[model samples]
Target: MTPPPPAEPVAAMVRPASRYRDSKVNRDLLGVMKGTSIGYWALLGLCVLMVHVAGGIWVYQVYKGLGIAGYAHPVFWGAYIVTFVFWVGIAHAGTLISAILFLFRAKWRNSINRSAEAMTVFAVLTAAQFLGIHVGRMWKSYFILPYPNQRGLWINFKSPLMWDTFAISTYATISIVFLFIGLIPDLAIARDRARGFRKGLYAALSLGWQGTTNQWKAHNRTVLHLSGLATPLVLSVHSVVSWDFAVAIVPGWHSTIFAPYFVAGAIFSGFAMVLTVMIPVRRIFRLEAYITDYHFENMSRFILLTSIIVGYAYLAEFWTAWYSGVEAEQSAFWLRAFGPYWISSWVMIIFNGVLPHILWFKKVRTHVPTLFVLSVCINIGMWFERYVIIISGLSREYVPAVWGTFTISWAELGIVGGSFAFFSMFFLIFLKLFPIIAIAEVKEIAIHERAHAEEGAH
Candidate 1:
C-alpha cells in the first residue's frame, strides 16, 4: 500500500497562522492599543513630575556649582557616582539573557527574549540619564570627547572616562541593533495585522519583508551574526565599565578581580530587572502560553547559578583582602559589613546571595507570586550591592580626614525614581504598539513541540 499522504500542514490547520492577527499575543497587544491603561498613564505623569523636580535641582546645581548636592572637599564622588554605577550594573540582565542564552541555544529563552531585549534598551537609557545628570557641567559635557578643543588637545586613551565613553556607546549601539534585528520579523507580522497608521508604520519598519525564503534566511543569518558580535561586547561593555573604578588608585577601588565581578553582578541584576518587568507584563498581556513555566524555571536556574557566582566573588574578595594582609582592603571589607553602610551590605548578602537558593525547590521556582517577590528582592539586593561597593568603600578610605558619609538627596531620589517610571512607560507603550512576543519564533516552536508530541505518541 502507498504511504499515507502527509498530515495536514500546521499552517493549514490554523488559518492565517503566519500573521500576528492569528496570535493570542497580537490580540492582547491590540487590547492594550484601544486606550492607554490608567497605570501606564499614571506612571508617565509621575515620571514627568519627577523629571521637573530633578530639573529644578539641576538648575540650582548649574548656578551654584556641584556643591549643592553635598559633595564636600574630601568627597569628590557621592550619591550621583554611586547611582551611576548602580544603574549601569542593573542594565546588564536583558542583553545577558538574550545574547548569552541565544548563543547557548537555550530554547526556553526564546519565549522571553523579545521582552528581555527591550529591557536592555531601556536599562541603557536609564544609565545614560544618570551619566547626563552626574555631569554637573551638563551643557559642556561634550568637552569630554576627543575633539578639537580651544587648546586643540587630544583625548588620552589612557583615561578611564574615555574608555567608559567608548565602551558604553559601543554597547548601546550594539544593543539597539540586536533589539531591532529580532524585532524585524515581528514588525512584519505587525504590518500584516495592523490597520491605517499602525499598518503604515509597521509596514515601513518591516522593510518589505514578505517572509519569503530568502528574506527569512538573510534575517536569520543577520540575527545570528549580530548575536555573536554582541555576546563578547556584552562582557566587554561591563568589564570596561568596572575599569572606571578598578583603574583608580583609591584603596577600595583598585582590584584586578573587579572586571569579572562587576560583569557577573551586572548580569545577575539585569536578569532580575527582566523578571521584574516581565512577570506583570506577561500576565497583563495574557502571554502565559508563550512565556510558559518551563521558561521561568530555566531562567531561575540561571539566576541561581549567577547568585552563587556573585556570592563566591564576595568571598573571594574578602579572602584576598585577608590573605594580602592589606590594611585598607581589610578596612573596606569591615566597613562594608559593620559600618554605616552595613544595612545595605547585609541586605545584599541575604537577598541576592542567600535568598535565591529558594529556586532549588521546584514549587517555589514555578510559583508566580514567589518569583515576582523574589525578583523585586533581587533588584533591591543588587542595588544594595552597588551601594555597599560605592558608599561603604568610598566613605572609609585610607585617609581618615577624607572619609565622609554619602547621603542621597531628594533630587537624586527623584531622578532615580523617574528612571524606573521611564522604563515602565516605554515598555507599556511598546507592548501596545508592537507584538510583545516574537510571533514567528513562537509559531515555529509550537509547531516543533506538536511534532515531537505526535512522534512520541506513535
Candidate 2:
C-alpha cells in the first residue's frame, strides 16, 4: 500500500503554560459568578440580620444617648474608636499587598491582589462608620468638612482629626478608583460571558473596554501611576491615625515612636485579616490551584516579619518610657503591663508577638487551618492593642481624681458585631457581582509561562 501513501508527519501538540485552558478558566470562574449556594444565602442572611440589629442599636443610642453605649468620663474614646482604629489598620494590608507589592513586581500577588484591594476599600468604609458613631451626633459629623456655608465654619487644618478626615477620605477615594481601574479587563471578561441585566451591568462598569492593545497599554500605565500614588497614602493614612494619639500629651499617647509603631501594627493586623478572609475564600471557590501553598507560605513569612517589627515596637515603647525618666510615662507603661487590664495586654503580646512565631516553621506556614486560627488570634490581639493604647492612655491621666475604669456595654458590642457583619456582607456581595480573580492578569501570567515553556522545549 506504499506505506499508507507516506502519511504526513503528525503535528506536535502545543502545551498550554498553565494547566487550565482559557475556556475552562472562564467556565470555572463564571461558575462562581453565576450561582450561589444555600450556605452562601444563609450566611448572607445572618449578616443582614446582624447589620439590622446594629442599625437598630445605633438608632436607639441616637434617641436615648451615647451614655447607653460606653462613653464615660476619661474613656470618651471607647469601643467605637478602638473598632475604628482596628478596621483602619486592617485596611493597610490590602494596599501593602496590592499596590506596594505590585510596584515591586511580585508575581505571586496576582492571585490575591484583587481580593486584597477589595478588602481595603470595604474596610475603609467600615472604618468610616465608627467616625460618625464615635462623634455621637451623626448629623453634625458633616461639620468636619470644610465648605462655604452661611455660618462661617472651617475645618481645623492643624488638628490630627482634620488630617485623619483628609487621609481616610483620600485613601478611600484612591483605593476605590484603583480597584475599579484594575477590574476593567476582568469586567470585560464578565461582560462577554454574561447575559440579561448582568451583561449590561458589567458592560457599563467596564467603561467601553474592547481588549485592544492600546486599551491594555493605557490600563497598565494608569495602574502604575495609581500604585505609586497609593503606596505613600498607605503609610500616611495610618501615620496620621497614630497622630490622633501621638499628638496628645497623655502619658502613653505622646511619643515619636507611635507613627512607625502604629504603621507596623496596622500592616500586621491587615495581613491577619487578609488571611482570615482569603483562606475561606480559597476553600469555598475550589481555587487551590490558583491560590496554592506558595502564596500562603509567602504570606506567613510576611506575617512573621511584621510580628518581629511589632514586638520591637512593644519593647521600644517600654524602653522609651523608662529611658525618658518621665514618671507619668513610666507609670503608664507599668500599668499597661500589670494593671487591671493586664490580661488584655498579655493577650495582645501572646497573640501578636508570640503566636506568630509558629509561622517560622515550614509546616505551620503551609497549614491552612493553623494559619486561619493564628490569623483570628492576631486580629483579636490587634484589637486589644488599640484598646490598650487608647483607653489605657486616657484612663490614667496625671490627675488621680479623674482616673476611671471603662467597660464596653451591650449596645457597643452589638455595634461592633454589626460592623463585622457589614464588612462580610459587602465582601460577599462583591464576590457575587464580580470575578473574584483577575481573569486577564491570570491569563497573561499563563501566557508568559507558556512562552517560556515553548522556548525551553525547543
Candidate 3:
C-alpha cells in the first residue's frame, strides 16, 4: 500500500509507514538545495560583509600593533582567545552526536548528526583562525604547526599549547573525512536528480556510488570504523584544550577537575550551539518535515544533563578552592564572584546552571521557539564561562600592582562578531551544497519502521 502523507518528522518515523515514503524524504531533503530566497541571500551577504569588516579590523590592528586590540598586561588572552575556546568547545557536540552516539547505537542521532558534523568541522575551522589572531602576527602563525621550519624553528613539544595544535589539526582532518564519507550516498542521490554542471560536480564527488550491495557493505563498515575512531576525540580534544590552562600554575585554572569540567561544559555549549543554528535552519528550510520536536526534546535533555554537570563543576570549583585553603585559589574564586567581572560570573551561573532546569518540563523542551531562546542564552553563558576563566582569572593575580584590567576594544568585539559571521557564511554556503539531514540513514530508519508497521498490520 502507498503511504498516505507526511506527518511530523518524529511522528513520521513511527506512524503507520503509510504516512511517509522514501520519495518524501528525498524530495524534502533535496528541496533545500533547489531554492535560494532573497532572505537567505541577504543573510549570507550580511555575513560576508561582517567578515570583511573583521578582516579590515585585523589589518588595522596589524598596522598599528597588537596593543590596539587589548592584549595588555595580565589579560593577554582577550576576546580572541575566549572565542577560540568557545568555538573549540562547541565543536565537540558534533563528534558526540555523530561519533559517540553512533557507537552507542543511539538512533535519535540519525536526523541531527549530519548538521552536527558540519557544525563541528566549521567550528573547528573557525577556531583555528584564532591561533593566528591571538599571536597578533598572522604571518608567523604557521610557527605553531608541527613541522620544523626553514628558519630553524622547531615546535615546542612540551607545551600544552603545542598539544592544541596537534589536537585541532588531527580533529579537523578526521572530522572533514568523516563528514565527506557520510555525504557520499546522499551526493549520489543528488547526482541522479541533478543536471548539467551540478550533475557533473555531484557525479565526481559521489565517487561512483552505484548503491550496490557491496558498496552498502563497504559504507557501513567504513562508518562503523570511523565511529570508533572519532568517539575518543569527543573526550580527548577538549581535555587537551583544558590542559592548556590546567598545566599552567595559574590559581583559578590549575585544578585537577578542569578536564571533566571543561569536557562537560563543552558538550553543554556544543548542544546549545547546535540548537541555536538548527532551529533557524529548520524553520528557514521548512525542515520540520524531518527535524521535528522529538529531536528537539532529545537535544534539550542533553542540554539538561550537561547543564547539571557544568553547574556542579561550578560549585565544585568553589568547594575545592575553599577546601584547599590556598589563598591565591580562594581569592581568585572570590574575585570571580565579587570582582569587576562578577556580572559575567553570575551570567554563567544563571544561564548555564539555573535556566536549563526548566527543560525538566517536557513542554519546554519540545517547544521550538523557547528552545531557540534558551540555546542562545547557553551560548552566551558559555562564552562568559570562558571569559571568566581566562580574563577574570588573569586580571587579578598574585601581585596587586601588576594586575590591570583588560578593557575590550572595538577591534576585539568586531573580530568576535566576525568569527560568527565567518562560521555562518560557510554554513550558509554548505546548506545549498549538501543535505543537512542524512538522507541515506533516514531512509534506513524508515525501512525499519515500515517493517514493524507491516508486522502490526498482520
Total colliding residue pairs, candidate 2 = 0
Taken over the whole model, the C-alpha lDDT of each candidate is: 0.78, 0.91, 0.91
Which parts of model 2 are misplaced by more than 4 Å? 1-22
Off by over 4 Å in 3: 1-22, 150-153
Q: After superposition, how far is residue 358 of candidate 2 from its true place, in Å?
A: 1.2
What TM-score, over all chains together, does every model reach? Answer: 0.91, 0.95, 0.93
Question: Which candidate do you rate higher for TM-score, 2 or 3?
Answer: 2
Model 1 scores a TM of 0.91
Q: Which residue pairs in candidate 1 collide?
A: 93-270, 93-271
Candidate order by lDDT, decreasing, is 3, 2, 1
lDDT of 1 by residue, 315-426 (tens): 8878888788999888888787788888888999999899999999999889988998998998999877877777677678888878888777666676666667667767
Give the candidate number with the greatest TM-score.
2
Task: For candidate 2, write residues 1-458 as lDDT tens digits.
Answer: 45566545545244453534446667776677778899999999999999999999999999988999989998999999999999999999889988899899998998888888899999999999999987778898988889877878667899999999999999999999988998999988888778999999999999889989899899999999999999999999999999999999999999998899899999999989989999999899898878888998898898999999999999999999999999999999999999878888999999998999998899999999999999999999999999999988989989889999988999999999999999999999999998887777788887898899999999
